[model samples]
Target: MKKALAVAVAVALTATACGSEEKDDAPQFAERGTFTYAIPADPGELDPANAVLGATNTVLAFAYDTLVHSDADGKIVSGLAEKWQAQADKVTFTLRKGVTCADKSPVTPQTVADSMNYLSDPKNKATLLGVLIPAGMSATADEAAGTVTLATKDPNPFLLESMTAVYVVCGEGLKDRSVLKTKTSGSGPYPLFESVANDHYVFKAREDYAWGADGAKYEPSMPAVVDLKVVKDESTAANMITTGGLNGAQFTGADRKRVEAVPGIRKGSAPDGIGEFFFHQGEGRAAADPAVRKALVQSLDLNELRTIASGGNGEAATHLTSLAPDPCRGDSVTGNLPQSDPAAAATALDGAGWQAGTDGARAKDGKPLKLRIAYQTSAGPGVQAGMEYVAQKWKALGVETELVGSADAKYSDSLFKNGDWDMAWVPLGLSLPTQLVGYLSGPGPDAQGSNFAHIANTTYDDLAAAAAKQVGAAGCGQWTNAEAALVKNVDVVPVVRPTQLVASKGAMVEVIGGVVRPTSIRMLKN
Candidate 1:
């Protein structure tokens, strides 16, 4: 869902890299315990239909249940729906029997249909429009058969896989969506017990919970209560995890080293999140010029930038989708990006009629080459330093640079609504290539699409359209070509895939796209 940050709109996806291994001397599981964790920021919207940030998804995961479940390796398995069949244009999900909502109401086939229909409707304007469920998709229920069939107007090869992210709201929540802001309704292992904005959220496991990934049932070893506290500072979170104040927390910067030093603390790593760049190619923007965009990318030492941005915890990215279990797995970004050569960048800028003055300032037709760059401050100091480094390199190139750093809310507004930026550090964390289409091609903010960059790469668009029609891994070649087209055209730049690190003190944490999966949590007894 870059409902993962400009999720390349606001979400950033990350997958766990460790903690799935079993050892001969594995720790014993506790009968019951409180599994508390940290979220970097507050998840503003609790409604599953409107969740835009990864933190929101993290919080909602406890209360909501998707139609399908993704296993440790991201394989689609049974969730709320037991058995499912997918097609290019449609998917049928057979609901598991004896499932119930938070209010103890039976989860009928219509319950699932209504949730899907709500997202499909244009009037509802759900955030996951085409990301989770395809656009123009409709749902029909066969109550007698205990199945819900979703038919899409456009062909969607990853329909079943995408449904893993679609959080189905219970009938009561749908009837009065406001209730969702403070409570839970869907059937999950845990139900929302309490919620305090910018503070903490608590969930208690359901005693009779039976349905989970692959028919998993609630056990005595699982946490009785899950407490999610919002800790904005990474250092503080690291400290909390080490001292047993928090059972789990993700560390992305200097604090990561602090937590890893604690010998007994469990950790999971993933090359899921990326520190990518998006240029505003809209009319009148300097980045709209392909030469300028290329020059900007070429001016900086991306390898050094990656090291700085990730606090020396990441490697060079080779594709757009940084999240794990990527359906289209391949290297599409390796040779596509412009190599770092400041001199070549200057030459390219000069060739584009941008002349350098006596003070080394570049201008064209008396208009100085000024560019405004913005990034989400929530990404931490490392990211800010990386953005500042970009400004420094551009300054050497005689370009006037303005850096604006804001939190998620303001940054999201600037990207999708105000459009008051030239270049942005917006990483759309997507596991599937089809998810990138809405952000990189098609209509933009004005048309209610996620193309905040206003990119119009026809080559990429054509390739992506063809790729979307192909079913699953068979379209990897086409998808790779489509992504290559975007990079070659300078519409977007893949910087580095940062390693996402989560440290747990007493609970075994499994992260999916940077958030701890509620079902994968188990209290450990040492």
Candidate 2:
């Protein structure tokens, strides 16, 4: 029952828009105005299951349609699945008929089943499938019945929510995964018309596509073209927004005030569901000690951190999961956080038999307390500032922190996987709760491959499993328990929850919704 309630709340938050009282009055764009958007990074892949990076996820969000989708309010809504049901451990979805893929092939239960099967296949390099689809589960289609049956190993309460991540792809066009590097074929409303690597991408709406809500605020207004430009620099992106070079673009902390101050520049923020510093716990003298980790946690001033990290654009996060404005609803263990007292931090070091050295850095047995902290240069300006802030704070606490910045495209994956640094920064999206599996489970990187922390605990794993099986209120306790255990054990430190900012030209293009989703963007002609 509690599980059911939790699921309901989660669905409600994802499907309904927060603070959306006024009806959207933005005029629809002309049938052929090309809406150019600026994105910081280029998408790594067009394939939904293989693209784990945030930029890639952004592209996939626009290119594909899942069985279920969430609205601005975080409530669950129908996508490809018109209706669904669960009985015991089996869940079935009634596919929406008459939907066609980019190849003009009709969307059927078989297409969904085939796509899911490809994802579930261990041989496939699809990382997201392992987390979204449970092991031993198989998808089967019945054309006559117009339904797809999913058989799970356990009473998977989050099956429908999980299906929201498995995008339906055309079985015919997807002969090789490499083709995703250049082409896309899905049952989404938008079609990839053309793509220029690292520069621009264009999507044209499908006239025959019709699977959105009955009264969706914004549909495909510009049916002819939706263009995306890759602008690496925030200043350039902002300039594009102001000069009418682009209709919309995401902004970071440094550009927040500037963009908000621009006349007729509208802004929107969503709880991005990621706020944590990845502690490289595998090796190194300082990081290898649990007491050192606890002291670092105690020494962090969250309010100050929030100000520096977010440039006053975000609030300090007290828990691992985001707060009420988030799509995924779960209680955070903010109270259980180690006390933010520098004196206590010093005492913790003292208790661990570490004494201050001549240089004001902590040392135990003549070894200095020092560790290398890494941050990806491509994570945008905000993250780079946050890393520097953390370094300064740790230095005050008698810890020597070496800041290492990487410019490599896959720097994060390499850093975490190779245990190359003492700490790193990462972002986790809230679209699916099952994303926690890799961090907690000990199978060494299964599917969805990013268990870089290599963190594992039997008790926490059990709790996570139990939580996964619950849907509503019952699941909350389990989720809370798991979170508490993770935090208490210092599995990951909670940082400031950063809001995703999109800078748009208010005069030329009015943003209809509060938080503009990838699929919900529609330019309004002034």
Q: Which candidate is the best by lDDT?
A: 1
lDDT of each residue in 189-278, candidate 1, tens digit only: 788888899999999999798888788788898899999999988888988888889998877778888788896787677664666888
Indicate which candidate wins on TM-score: 1
Q: Superposing all C-alpha atoms, what RMSD in Å does each candidate have to the true structure?
A: 2.6, 5.9
- Global fold similarity of model 2 (TM-score): 0.85
Q: Identify the runs in model 1 with alpha carbons over 4 angstroms from their true place.
A: 1-24, 446-449
Model 2: lDDT equals 0.63
| Candidate 1: Cα lDDT at 24 | 25
- What TM-score would every model get versus the actual structure? 0.92, 0.85
Query: What 10-residue stretch in candidate 1 is worst by lDDT?
Result: 15-24
